[model samples]
Target: MSELGKKIATRESYGNALVELGKEHEDLIVLDADLAGATKTGIFKKAFPERHWDIGIAEANMTGIAAGLATCGKVPFISSFAMFAAGRNYEQVRNSIGYPHLNVKIGATHAGISVGEDGATHQCLEDLALMRAIPGMVVLNPADDVEARAAVHAAYDHVGPVYLRFGRLAVPVFNDEATYRFEIGKGIVLKEGKDVSVFATGLCVNEAREAEKLLAADGIDAEIINIHTIKPLDEKLVLASAAKTGKVVTIEEHSVIGGLGSAVCDILSEKQPTKVMKIGINDVFGESGPALELIQKYGLDAQSIYEKVKAFVKQN
Candidate 1:
């Protein structure tokens, strides 16, 4: 495993990637809903003034414009908070982009309760479910800086609507930029073990790694796999891991109802029947608080995950 490196938010990586992609892919166009600053699309805006536009808080309108641009042979990327991009613009995205299968990339930043004190209105826990519900939509939730940037390139290469979820909180950069490989619909095994498989995504991946250490102290050998792509999930990898361990635990920052946990359950329940424990936000709304505090209070912190997994292993 690569050593843990500096912390960087995946949302920041999304913006930097757009600037680089714009330099190479001239057909690439960026559209923001008056949140270029927060979404970090302003970096692309400053670099390519003519190619980027602010739709002025009209997320649904921006979605339509992006779809129209896609039909005209332009690869348009729409940027906004996950709530507005995936939630508020669900209809436009489903009809305009998903229906025709347009090559439009949706960069939904500040997802999950990790958006800090932005509260429940801005924090989007249902984006994965919403995007996954759209037929032919490619859903991706990258784990770190390297994976996030690579996902942007992958989304551009994919010839259909893609939803990319990013976070506001800075997470540990554990993957080596030069050596790490990022592929859509593939999961990476960060650690190999035999007792149980701990599948994780987004910022929760780092916390899972930390929990792995605590689990080790208790003589629990937990396997860690980063499920970066939620939709088009790495079913083969998931089944292989579950077969090896006979037990599974899925961790994510979003709600357990329709996120990574649910996707994992859908696969394992059908092909490889195994014991599963889901660790994520319950079907409850988030409250205003510090990002780290919310994560802990909601029982997503490393210690909380460790305790829960330990109990699960002991009980089962």
Candidate 2:
């Protein structure tokens, strides 16, 4: 395992990536629903003021505007909290952007319970499930700063509607920016082990990595894989890992029902039929608290994952 680098939020990376892409692609424009600063799209707004639009608090209107921009051959990225971008503007996103198969990128930030003090209403646990249901929508939940920035570039290059999920909390920088490569629908195996395969996405990926170290201390060898792309899931890699280990565990910051865990189960139940375990926000809403404290309360911290996986390995 590589030494963990400084913690940086994926939302920050999303903002930086837009500026980088804006330089190369003049048609790239950013639209935010009165959350430019929080969503980090303000960074892009600063660099290219003319290309950025603040659509007030109207998320649906912003989505419609982005769809219109896509029709004119402009690559528009609509930014907002996940609750609004994916939840409040679902109809517009599905009809205007998704149905038309426009070249629009939806940058949804502050996803999951990690939205912290904002509480359950602001924290969106259903965005992944919602976006994944949309036809022709490419859903991406990057694990770290490097992957988040790379995913932004990939979304800009890919045609059709893309949903990019980002987190406000800073996480461990696991990937080396110099050598890391980000693909649209591929999984990266960070560590190899024979006991079990632990697949993780978003903020949970780094926590899973730390859990792996704890599992190692207890003589449980585990394979850690990063499933950044949730919609066009890397089924090939998923099945291969499950086949190798016969035990699978999926961890995500989103709800267990329609997020990475559910996606993995959908594929495995059909083909591999391996024993699978899901670690995430169960069927419960989150409460207002410190971000890290909320993570621990919800059993999403590194210690919690370690305990759960260790018991899982022992029992099954």
Best by lDDT: 2
Q: lDDT tens string, model 1, 132-194?
A: 989999999998888899999999989999999999998889889879888999999999999
RMSD after Cα superposition, model 2:
1.7
Pick out the ten consecutive residues of candidate 1 with the lowest summed lDDT: 1-10
Residue 271's lDDT in candidate 2: 92
Off by over 4 Å in 2: 1-4
Q: Against the unseen true structure, what C-alpha lDDT does each candidate score? A: 0.93, 0.94
Q: Could you tell me every candidate's TM-score relative to the true structure? A: 0.98, 0.98
Model 1 alpha-carbon drift over 4 Å, by segment: 1-4
Worst 10 residues of 2 by lDDT: 1-10
